[model samples]
Target: MAERKHDRKFVRTFFTTPTAVEGEEDSAKMLRGAVGLRGMKAPDVWVPDNEDATAPSMRDEGAENIVEVVAENGADFPGEIHPRVVWHRDSPATRYQGFKHMLQISDPERGAIEHIDGFVIPEVGDIDDWKKADEFITIVENEHGLEEGSIAMSVIIESGQAELAMGQLREEMGKPTNNLERLFLLVDGEVDYTKDMRAITPTGALPPWPELRHNTSRGASAAGLIAVDGPYDDIRDVEGYHERMTDNQAKGMLGIWSLTPGQVVEANQSPLPPENGSWLLDVGGRKVELESEDGVEIYDGNRLSLEETGDGYVLRVGGDGRELDEDELREELLDMTEYVPSMDDIVDSMEEFEAAKEAGRGAIAITQSATLRIDGVEIDVNKDRMWDEATYQAAMTPITLFQDVYRNRPDQHEELAEMYSEDVVERAMDVGA
Candidate 1:
């Protein structure tokens, strides 16, 4: 993939705050508050939303507020600021309104253009619709005397045509008329997408369209852009939100639309490697993690048990017991055991492999074992994982993510230091250099 236009390597959270807040005396109160955030509360990409979040009657005032507030606070803010402008593939007036806002915000005389990173065009349709948005941004840059591709354009995949257009982005990038290379993020808008699909759920809640998320991630990977999941409306359900992030992370989508600052902190920290390693046991095809007590691995679950017998001991797995010798027990445990390495463990393994690579070794196998005592019987379990050049390169992802967070978010430095210590953090910064 070609190098992307933007310099942002980590966009773990995309926070959208309404530019205008109703019932508040100061219409720009929310925008001011979002812009003034610092430390862990600040999002990776701060969006001053002027579309769905703001009422139609107040959108004009909201646009002005975005320019004013962003100009004042954008310098101190540590994240990229991309304001969401109003646009629909079917509505010309809305597209024009969005165009006018971009012109207003991108004008150098307004004092906000220097602080603005880009504009997010929502409700985009086919490739032509995307090109229209790109053309608008290009015109704004030329009209403002800015660099040709200095301003980035991110789109929300809300319609079926937009979803299909993602597949055609690579071929379309070769064209010279519009600056399609300025595309930065491909964010999911499941609410609108569901409406577009006419999908219905008994609970009336939005369906979890896992296929759409996978396609978005795949498209972003193919086109070299960032993929972000849609918003989780239940802000209070933190566990559910974490589960969503976990699922998205598995699909290579690290970013999510955060509706609040509290959610921003969660999303920002979700993609990093765990501070400690863990062990997992397969219990009837489901993986169950064992707990640690004073550095000893313990499994108190009822899935596996040990019974005394005259010969030796009977191992019961899922209520099925059979007499087994020591060797059989070891083999059984080994087959069911899985080792999940921590950040420290991965670093140590990578460092060892790097030294081996220096010695001209192509691959190496590492062993991880644990001893668990259940019902007065002790059994040892070990699993071997191989590390090659490809494995080492893949393991470097979390380290690179840590480096990006360390570089872009200085406000999060203190927390990172506490998680992995100053020494580890310093070493991680220098890794893959």
Candidate 2:
């Protein structure tokens, strides 16, 4: 069937970093470089299943920098999930941050994690997919020693089926428990999604994929779930990867997948829009310079102000006014300015994200549950959950089982707003608008 224009759009840019366990040398290099990321914050490492997950233990390097360790079941439980993961003899490593399996939310990993944070579910195309996920979760708790809603389950929106199923999916979001807390949207399952959209006419480079990406993001935003961007496989294409990530950032993706150590700096970077700058304007080809105090108005309308600091000249905007949302703006500014992190050290990229967060510029990532305003719209987001209202109501589940930080504390609002800002949030809200 043909698609419509009013599809849901992606809100936050999510970078689901994937590393191929093949070729020991390359994997090691990627891991080493990733660990050395400027801010010392490691990228969200995705160690897929059907690989050498047990041996070598990528756990050490991944210990600190890891955000969410997604054991993608797609590689093993391909096409569709059947009941639950067979849970081979192996599969350990519990001490990572936000550790969970990425099986289809429709089915449980059974004994995958008797006590763990979360799991993954692929190709969540519609309400039925979630309904099936709900059923599967029930089976796990009743028969497999799986505590109801004890583990957080996430969803991946790949393929045309999930796109078509968006409307219905929204209606059935929380499920029988209303305890369903968070939904993790996999970055790019469209590699498989395009295959599913076979019936639709090929719409050139940006087919159902981009639209599908936009829709999933919007759905997640509306539902207050986390939407991650798909991985960029072509590793060596450094500049190309940055450009693609820039595109995703434009779409307001939370974080982009980091394939190699080199890409980490780029992924950690927030969009550099020149809302206020003579330097940025010049970099953007506007060639504007401040001659006198009267020239300050050159950046009028923009909430930016030019100042100096230990790190060369700094452009600080009063509110969140934006200038250039393109690489030329940042590149030109970086080239024109004497910002630190020198030529030999890419520390600028590493420290830039953290620095931005500290300056109240934007969020490093959506590390917790908070309300995000994308384009003046408020989105209530939570990163954890229980199984369902039915399960909770039946006393089969514990309401306070998951670690959600704070549940509606008035004081935390300001802190959360600073963590996940509107710049990143606004990216997706403006989709199609």
- Model 1 misplaced stretches (Cα beyond 4 Å): 1-3, 308-310
Q: Which residue window of length 10 is worst by lDDT in model 2?
A: 396-405
lDDT per residue (tens digit) for residues 1-433 in model 2: 1111111122222223323344465443443332233231333333332122323355333322122222222222111111112121112232111122222222344332322234455545455555455455555545545455554455555556666665454565555554344344434566657656664555544343566667756765566554566667677877777777566655645455454545644554333221222222232334334221332212332433544335333444455333443343344343433211111112222234445545775433322123322222222333322323232232211111101111212233343335445443233222212
User: Model 2, which residues run further than 4 Å from truth?
Assistant: 1-41, 45-47, 50-116, 141-147, 177-182, 199-208, 271-278, 281-433
Error of 2 at 338 (Å): 20
Best candidate (score: lDDT):
1
Q: Could you tell me the lDDT of residue 195 within candidate 2? A: 58
- Count of residue pairs whose backbone atoms collide, per candidate: 0, 48
What value of lDDT does candidate 2 attain over all alpha carbons? 0.38
